[model samples]
Target: MPAPPPSRVTIAFCTFNGAEHLEDQLASYLAQTYENWDLWVSDDGSTDNTRAILHAFAQAHGHTRDIRIIDGPRKGVAANFLSLLCHPDFPRTPCALSDQDDVWLQDKLALGMAEIHGEQPCLYGAQSVHTISDLTSVGRSVGAAPLALKTISFGNALVQNVVSGHSSLLNLAALDLVREAGVPQDIQSHDWWLYLLMTGAGSRVVVSEREVLFYRQHSANAMGAHQGLRASMLRAMRVFGTTYGAWIASNTAALRRVDTLLTPQARDTLTALENAPKKFAALKRLGVLQRYGIARQNRFGTAILWLAVLLGRC
Candidate 1:
């Protein structure tokens, strides 16, 4: 018998004024070891030559690969990705998220496909190699520590997002879970919401040990790749502010719409978080969060998160 055909994958790419590095990113797609994939890009009204570059790429590779370009929702990056996720023509295949500037390694798709398994609703993501604007290697985006599956829960997702959209690949069942949940309004980040929804619904999230792509960091990055003291301080401040509280409130309301979809434990945790504000003291709120196992990826981060909860910031 002939060898089994490779699993079909669809890449949901979102772009803005990314013409500078778009070509390099597109070229990386062509170099993928897994060739049975389609690229669907939603361009958010670019004034630069981004449209021209996309059209040229499509014209050249259209016969061999499924390359499509469509207008974005014109809201924001998260909205643009959400629009692509809900696109009528989006195929019911394994889907991966892509940024306009990141370069995927040759085996990125193959690695994700091998791990996803398609047995249940699952998400696959790997570490990325941080790079300068010119693709000069900096270091790994994440540390060498293995991701703890126990910490990969809705409770933790409510407090911190561990998944990077650019490195995420969702199986068909996982994709269906998000699609059925519907896009939430005023969502701060699409990847965060996905992490919440999937884990809340008891999906398996796999983090690969190998790095899968080069994450380009530059001045124009919406979310920079900085993880220094200053960056960490700023992030801590953001989490301790009213903005983060409002974000959680908005996300909670959105999750309520699909409350039936979440597992009983997740539903209870959500309820506990929502009710924490009613507690008289900050320590009480912290206790509630701790009881639910709401935590960040690292111990230091989790400590800061505890402080945020104690101050009623989260």
Candidate 2:
């Protein structure tokens, strides 16, 4: 079921070194089938042509959405996004996070906005488009699916993230939850932290396989398409032990910042995680192989996810 249009949204766009395709991206947004969005763009000190292009776009489409080009000191991807969310100019209702590179489908905004409404402050999901060696391959479709509530259960929520910063839409109420819980400014990926906390906070992480955004896989992508088993194993080994701890610590600190932003459900989730066994052998320490920590597993699955996480396979 395609979701209905959100009454309005303020699109938060962060760009750095995005000049090559900047115009294309802006055009896509301008061409959105659904209107009613203001654009908030922050250039992370791009030495490239990104600034000029954005300036031109704003001059031409000034009224498209209260376009504003602001100053950004290139904090980083995670921090940059945090700035977008916390920016005072952003509207208080529903907000959509956008990326500089991806091409937006015509109905992307309308489709994502529909699901973001309702009682729970839900997070809409995204589909990936694999660009292998310049070949753009079609992946997930954009047709809406029923938002699966149980998919984001507390225990299961601890492991993987469901929200894509680029394709996601966060409701105002969820903003309250996020503000209370505070995002870890110093984490591996901002979206992943949002996944764990928001899901645990009783927000629905709806997996809308509907392909609205074209996930461009290139040398610059933060995450790429799955590599072979050997590479995966090596990366998992690296991630589980030292890498995982460092990541958790960074994210934990970010969580502490937004501790008050947490909802009751989110607080309980943090409590469970904090109280879990010291070794954290379940999912935190190991990769998968428990009933719900990493990936629901027992003995064999644990080892499997362990290897996967270690090798970057997961």
Q: What is the lDDT of residue 293 in candidate 1?
A: 86
In model 2, the number of clashes is 27
Cα lDDT of model 2 by residue, 1-314, tens digit: 99966477878889998987777778889889878888888788899999999888888889545888887747788777766676666667777778887778899888888778786777776664544434376443222222432345545445444456677788778766666554355677767766766765667777776767666666677353333454345545544556665665566556656656566755655555555454524445342224234452123334654564444433
- Tens digits of per-residue lDDT, candidate 1, 1-314, equal 99989889999999999998999999999999999999999999999999999999999999987888999989998889988988888889999999988999999999998888856999877788888888899777553224543467788788777778898899999988888887778888898888888889999988776888998877766364535566677778887888987878888888989999999999999999888763348787888878998877777778887877766676
Evaluate all candidate structures by whole-model CA lDDT and list the values in order: 0.84, 0.65
**Weakest lDDT window of 10 consecutive positions for candidate 2:** 141-150
TM-score winner: 1
Q: How close is candidate 2 to the true structure, as a TM-score?
A: 0.79
Q: For each candidate, what TM-score against the reference?
A: 0.94, 0.79
